[model samples]
Target: MKNTIIIIISILLLVFIFSGCGPEKKKVAVLIYDMEDPFIKGVSEYLKAFDQKSYDITYYDSQKSQIVQNKIAEKLYKEGVDLLVINPVERLSSYIFVKKSLQEEIPIIFFNREPLKEDLEYFEDVYYVGTDARESGMMQAKLISEGLGNDTENLGGFDKNGDHIIQCVILKGEQGHQDAEERTKSVIEGLKGEGFKVEVLHTKVANWNETKAYRAMHEIMSEFGEDIELLISNNDAMAIGASKYLMDNGYFGMEVDGVVTDIPFRIVGIDGLEEAKLLTKKGYMYGTIINDGKSMAEAIMQLSEYILENDEEKLQYELVDNKYILISYKYHSNE
Candidate 1:
């Protein structure tokens, strides 16, 4: 009887040990700058829907505050998360998180809002996954030039005053955001490079908010009236907002019997959101550049997997400079 009882106890111990040895899920913490931003919200939703069997992922919103982001980072760090994917509120403040990540020996993947190059170089394990800002701006210019018939002499009837110069209004994303600055600057440069004469009527800083862009459009239209020939926006949300204002005031087209009519002025933006694509197809908006959020989410997850497994082969996206993964942007228009 004693021998039988000893054998039973040994078998139970063996079973317990085997069960405990099963693969454990890696804890991943994703920190987003603002949940309200449409682009960021789309990216977050993609991250949330990733395969959950191997990773235990959680999301934190910074509420557009660097201070709030810092606090959330600290809390996540204390909780012993294995990895961090952050879209920083303030690009410069990335250094703070980098230092902490280095000290804690945790890998980080910064996406969307890129950090300073110097900060990214501080750690070997740190990585950035995002689309090129300048590329998006250049694409925006291409769409605009094409929409206007690529004619310097006539501007495809878009030159309302027949001055051969496009009178434009710009809706800027944010004050100091790198993407915003780069996109705004590159678009203007690109147009000039294409041998098109452009005159900016007014530029309003909308901070990437649709409501703010709506209000800014109102103010701009009030000041400039019909002299505004083209509207350029840094993102689709703002473009959509501006389009709404234009439609309400009879500037944009109204659909009648499933056909949009009475369209005036050309409008273009970056970030190829679904609504923007539909609008472009229906001739409500000119064009947009695809930011490709789904691809970004996949890249971030692959990087996270590579970090957890310590296998570079796990990365599917081409990592440039051993630190960055740049996703390409494509121009979308009604072709």
Candidate 2:
């Protein structure tokens, strides 16, 4: 009877140990400007795939207010989250949240966009995972420069060296957003390198709003009339705004056919949205590169796991592009 009791006790002890060996639970927070944005959609989708893992994702959206985003970050930090993934609204203003997270000793990963590198370099704990913004912009510029030969004969535009010297109306994003600033800078530099400098007739701030884009494009239409040869928007929404102006001014019909109809004369922008892709495919606009946001999130997830198991002192500051993904129908239709 004593031997039977010992066996039962041993079974209970084994059950206790095995039950205690379940996976460690992790709680993470994801902060973004808005969920409607494609970048956020991609990140959320990526996070959902890992539901079987021992993790929780709390979402916070700033609804286009820097102060609100800052508040959300602070709240998440105070909640003692194991990790924070952010798509910041502004570069400098959001650093205070970074400071708070660092003070609390939680790991951070800036998603889709990065903080100011100058500030980030000082904070050794923050990790950023996204496309190389400058390189992405440069790729767009190279496509435009190469299309110069195609631009003039079709659009009655002037040529400079091997590229076209088209008058550009630029609708840039917020001034303090690092991605916007870097993308604009890189595209301009790339264009200059091709021996054809785009004369920026106006560089207005759209703040990543469709309404702002529409308003700015309207102003550009009234200011330059039809003299604006091209619109190089920083985002697809702004590019669609520029296209609205073209449509409003009756620039898409028979009159555009003779002197400047053959060359594509609409707004060219990024993010590879469905509308952007459709327009580019139909010869209404030039499409852009599609950064694989899902792959980026997965890589970040792996990196975090590696760090949790390995030496934290050996943390590497890294940049990754899983592939050179350009989604232009004219160019990379295979993608």
Candidate 3:
């Protein structure tokens, strides 16, 4: 009995030592795409609102360049960061970083965008926490369809005419952005399933640049005329670019380029920006879908803490759904 009691005491001492002597201060590296972008600005702004003496957070800007980003990530790995949070620029190019991090045994929390999951699977404990783009796209699609109903003339039960078509010009992000791919696919599928004849006259890749998006909008205007009913930019920045293009060309007939009406068409996008929200209140934009960036930042912080403190098996894929969609028409010129 004495021997068993002594064994228990030894186990208790080891546990106490392990708990008390935990790794001193964790260093985190955030590899992001274009820190200058308002979206990343929101994330970084919130991070600064906390006590940073306990945590070391450094953000590396890829400047939308995968080559530079890969280099930054490798240097961070070489310096031995405890955790790495990456907002990958390219879908497949991110394997360069993910593959290297695997050999290092560092945990990663991917937010907003994702690298290839198959490539990410090599890591010991990696968490995929962010929005569900496909579902969000579907939600945007459902709203657009309802807006079309407002456009469609009620032919009445006797007339039987469900043949209302919506002319749309899509502004896609860089070639392989998951947001551009999944969102465009979901929105298109949603419209197709509803028997809506959406003629996609112009689908241009903007690379998520405001100027590039503006230039693309100019070209779209030449081809489809300024009367294009619905403008679906993959994000708010691109949507604003299209709106600016319209305003510059003096096409104020129906500054309706939101999730509202497509005739004087409404404009629509995700990642609801503050300007977009205020515009909704001021009758500038028809509506926007809010991604809740502050919520994402808070989640990133909490999840990072949980991973460090708890030794539970992490998830294979976590769809941390910020499935919140806000459709407003306060910006409608007619309203």
lDDT of 3 by residue, 1-335 (tens): 99999999999999998988755788888878788677677876775664345667888888878788888887888889988888876667757666777788788877677666676566656766567777667767766655555333331111122345666778897666777888899988887776666778788998766678888876788888644667776777877777767667766544344432322466676677776565555444556666667767766776677666663232222433321112121212223
User: Which pairs of residues collide in candidate 1?
Assistant: none
lDDT of 1 by residue, 274-330 (tens): 988888888888889999998898899888888899898989899899899998998
For candidate 2, give the lDDT of residue 26.
Answer: 79
TM-score of every model versus the real structure? 0.94, 0.77, 0.77
- The predictions' CA RMSDs to the true structure, in order, are 1.9, 5.9, 9.2
lDDT digits (tens) for residues 89-199 of candidate 2: 765665776677668887777766666665565456677766677876787676665545434433334332334456777778778677688888888888777666567
Relative to the unseen true structure, what is the C-alpha lDDT of residue 253 in candidate 2, on a scale of 0 to 100? 54
Candidate order (lDDT): 1, 3, 2
Runs in model 2 lying further than 4 Å from the true structure: 1-24, 50-52, 150-164, 254-266, 309-335
Residue 318 error, candidate 1, Å: 0.9
Give the residue spans of candidate 1 off by over 4 A: 1-21
Q: How much is 255 displaced in model 2, in angstroms?
A: 15
